[model samples]
Target: MTIHRAHIAGAALASALSMTSSANAQALEYQNTSGGSVTVYGQLNFGYLNFDDGESTTDEIVDNDNSPSRVGMALVQPFGDNQLRFRFETALGLRSSSGISQTEVPDGIDWDRTNIRHFDFAWANPNYGTISLGQGSMATDGVTGADDSGTDVISNVSVSDIAGSFAFRDSTGALTGVELSDAFSTFDGGRRGRIRWDSPEVANFTFSVAHGTEILDEDADTDYTDLAVRYGNDFGDFNVNAALGARRIQPSGSDDEDYVIGSVAVHHAPTGLSFAVAAGSEDGGGDYYYAKLGYARDFFAVGTTAFSIDYYEGDDINGAGTSSDSVGFSVVQSLDSANSEIFATYREYSYSDGTATSYQDANATMIGARWKF
Candidate 1:
C-alpha cells in the first residue's frame, strides 16, 4: 500500500531528531506564609485541517478538539496533614475540528456555560485520600486513556475529534448522512456535576467512585454513577499504568445503560519505546478495541520528539450490525523553552452500515501547535 508523503516526512524528521531530554512548562502561581496558594494555567491549540470525503475535500483552520484551548485557576490551602482545594476552568469556545462539517463552518467564538470544565472543591489528606464536589470528572473519566507515548498532544483513541462532523460518502459519491462521530465512540466517561471519593493509594493502586448528573443541561434528567480503579508503578527501567472502570447511566424515564472500559500502557524509558491498548463495551450495544505503538527521544537540546501510530475498530457503534475503523499516524516536536509543541497527524476512517451499498473511506490531516502557560 502507498503511504502518504506527509507521514513519511514526519517519520524522517523524527529519525533525524532522535539524539536528546524532556522538559515541561510551569503554570503561574502565588503562595502565602500559611502554605496557601493560587495558580493560573491555560493552553492554546490551533491547527490547519484538510479532510477528504471520497468525493469532495474541505480545508480550514480549526481548534484541535483533542485538547482544546482553555484557561483555569486552582487554589489550595494546607493545614496539618489535610488540604483543601478549589478549581475553576472553562473552554474558550472557539470553532473546533470536531464541530465543523462538510457543509457548514461556524462563524466565530461562542462561549457559553457549557464551556465550563470544572467548578470543583475538594479536601484531601495523605491518610484519607480525597473527596470532591461540584462540576468535575466522573470516576471513569480517562479510565480507557492510559498512555505514556508523549504523542497525545496530537493523537489518541478519541479518533473522531479530528473530523467528527464530516459525513461519509457512498460508492456513488453521495453523502450517506452518517457522520463519523455517530459511528465512532470510546464509551469513556466525562465530567458532570458530581460528588466523588478516591481512596488512598495502596500497593500502587487506587479506587474511585462517583455519582453525578447533567447540571449544565437545564432540561436534561440523567444520572451517572461509576467506579474506577487505577494503578501506576515504575520498575527499574520500565513504567506502567493501567485502569479499569464501569459506569451506569439512568435517564428519568428510560431504561438504564451500562458500560465497562479498561486500558493499559507500558513504556521502556531507556529505549524510548511504548505501547498501549484499550477496550470497552456498552451493555447490549457496541464494543471497541484500540491500540498504539510509539517512540520518543530527546532529539534536540530543546526537548523530546515523539511519534506514534494507532488503530481502532468497533462493532455496532452507530446501530446494530454496523462497523467503524480507523488508522492514524502522529508526531509531536517539543520546544522546551517556549513550553510548546508543533505536531501533525493523519487518519483514515472506514465504516459499513451492514447494507448492500458500499461506502468510501474518509481521510483527514491536521498540522497544529499547542502552547501551555
Candidate 2:
C-alpha cells in the first residue's frame, strides 16, 4: 500500500485553471509526479481586486499588488500493501483574517498557529471497506459546497423567493447589524466526525451510506447524528449522482433541530453541468431550495497562452421572508505555473425585503497576474 499527505479540494483556490482531478480514493497519486516517497504542489495566489459597496465611499483594493500574497503547501505520503492500503494527507496555509471588525481579532496580516485548516486520514480497500477519522466533510454529502457553486453563482438567499423558500422565523422587521445566532446559520462549527461504508460498484452504479456524529452537548451528555443514503452512476455521455441527507442535531435538546438536504447533479462531457437542490425545514420549521444551470468551455490563446471561462447562478437562503440572496461570478486562468492570470468577479445580492441590499449587494472587479508552483 501507499500514502500521501495532501488534502483534496484544491479547487477552492482563487485562481488556477485546469480540469479538476479526482482524489485517488483507491490509490496514491503523488507518486505519479516525481516517482519518490513524497510529492508537493501548491498555489501561490496574487490578486488585484476592487470591492465596492454600491457607493464609491466604500471602494477598496483587496489583493495582489500591495496585498499580502496567499500561499499553501501540501505533501502526500503513501505506504502499505494495496497503495490505497495506507495514506496520510495534511496541508499548511497562510490566511488573512477578516470579520465584522478588522480589530475584533488581531490587527492585520497574521498566520494562525492554533487554528487548523485541514487534518484527516482515510483507509480503504475493495475487498474490505473504508473508514475516515478527524475533521472532514460528512459522509452523506457531495461537493455541493460554496466553492463548487461554479462561477458567479449567487448565495441561497434568492432561492428563498422560490415557491417554498420561506421558513418559520420571527424575522418580521428588517434586522441589520444584529446578526442571527448559530441557530439560523448552517456554519456552526460544532463537534463533527464521520463514518461510512460503500458497496462495490455493480455496472456503473454504486450504493453508499454514511453517518456523522457531533458533540452537541457536553453538560447533558448528548450529541448530534446525521444519516444519509446516495445513488450514483455514469452513462456514456454524462455522470449523474443523487443523495438524501438528514441531520438530527440533538435528539435530547429542547429545540431538537433536525433538517434534510437533497442534491442531484448531471455533468455532461466538455460543457454542460446541471444540478437540482432541495433543503427541508429543521424540526419541521419549513422548506426552501434552489436549482442551478451552468457550463464551462476553453477559449482561444491570448498573447501566447490559453484562456478559459466558467459561469453559473442561483442562490437562496433565509427563506422568502428574510434577507439572504446573492449571485456572483469569477474568471481565472494561469499566467504560468510560476506567474499569474487575469481575474474578475461580480455578485448581485437581493433580499426579500430592503435589507437584502445591506446584507448581500456588492460587485467585485479585478485584473492581474498570479504566481505559484
Candidate 3:
C-alpha cells in the first residue's frame, strides 16, 4: 500500500499544536427542586478533504461525516433505585464529506428530520437493567466498533465514511459509477425508532435486544430486530472491550437480510499500545474483516497523543464475486484545555469485480478538528 506524502505532512502539522486556553467545557445543566436535572451538550467537527480518484483530484471544506457536528439534551430524574432519562439529539446537517463527490458538491445546509439521532426515553434499574423507547439506537448499534484506541476520532472500521461518495475510475481514467460506499460496508447496526431493553451487567457482561422500524423516512417501511452482548473490563494495567451482535432487516415486500458482527479491543496502559479486530458476515451476501494497531501516550501535559493504522477487506459486498479493501493511517492529538482534538487521516481504497476491466485505486486525506461543549 502506498502512503501519501502529503498526508504525512498534514499529520505532522496536526501534531504540532501548542496553543493553550482556559477550559469552559462543562455541559450546560439545570436542576429543579424536584430532584431532576437537564444537561445540554454538543460538538462541532470541521475538516478539509482531499480526494484523488486516479483521474482527478477534488479538495474542499466539509463537515466530517466520521462524527459530524451535533447538539443534544439529556434529562434525568432519580426514583428510588431507578432513574428516568430522556435524550434529544440531532445532527447540524451541514454539507458532509460523505455526501460530496467528484460530480456533486452539495450547497448550503440541509436540515431535515433524518438528522435526528436520538429522541428517546429510558428507565433504568440496578436490578433489572434498563428499558428504552422512541427513536434511538437499536440493540446492535456500535456492536462492530468496540475500540479502545484513542485515535477513533479519525480512523475506525467504517472506512467509507471519509470519502464514500467519490466514484472509482476505470483504467482509462473514466468514472466507473461504483462509489466507495457501494463497495465497502461493515454491516454494523444503526439507530432507529425502537423499543430496546438491556439486562443488568453480570461479571462485566451485558445483554441487549431491540425491535424497531424506519420512522424518520416517511416512504420507508422496514422492520429491524437485533440482539447484542457486550463485555468491558479494566484488568489493572490492561483494558479490554468486546461486543457481538446479530440483526435482521425485513423491508416491505422484500427478502429479509440477516447479519452477525463482532469486535474486540485491548489496551495496555503501561506500554500505551492497543489492538482491535472486527468481523462480520451477511447471510448469503458479504463478509468482512478489519484490524487496527494503535499507540497512545500523554506525551504532553495537555492530553494524550494517539496514532493508528488499520486495514479492511470485504468479499461480495457489492455483488457476487466482488471484493473491496482499504488501508488507513491516522493521528489524533488532544487539546485538554480547549476540550478538543486535532486529527488527520490518509486512506487508500481498491476494488475488484471479477471482470476483465481494470480499475484504479482511490486515495483520500483529511485534516480536522472537533470541539465539544
Candidate 1, superposed: residue stretches over 4 Å from native: 1-25
Separate clash counts for every candidate: 2, 42, 0
lDDT of every predicted structure (CA atoms)? 0.89, 0.38, 0.89
TM per prediction: 0.92, 0.58, 0.92
For residue 247, give model 1's deviation from the true position in Å: 0.4
User: Per-residue lDDT of 1-373 in model 2, one digit per residue for the tens?
Assistant: 0012222433332113222343442222233332223222333333333444333312223223212233233333334432232222222322321121111322333444323323445565555555555544554444232222233221232221111111212233333442222112332123345455555555644555455554222345344555555666778877776666666665454666666666666667545444444344445454444454545445534322222232222222343445443344445543333344555544343434334343434333445444333
Worst 10 residues of 1 by lDDT: 1-10
The Cα RMSD of model 3 versus the native structure comes to: 8.5
lDDT of 3 by residue, 148-194 (tens): 77888779999999899999999999898799999989888899999
lDDT of 1 at 229: 99
lDDT of 1: 0.89
- Taking the tens digit of each residue's C-alpha lDDT, what string does model 1 give over 198-297? 9999999999999999999899899999999999999999999999999999999999999999999999999999999999999999999999999999
lDDT of 1 at 131: 99
Query: Which stretch of 10 consecutive residues in model 3 shows the poorest summed lDDT?
Result: 1-10
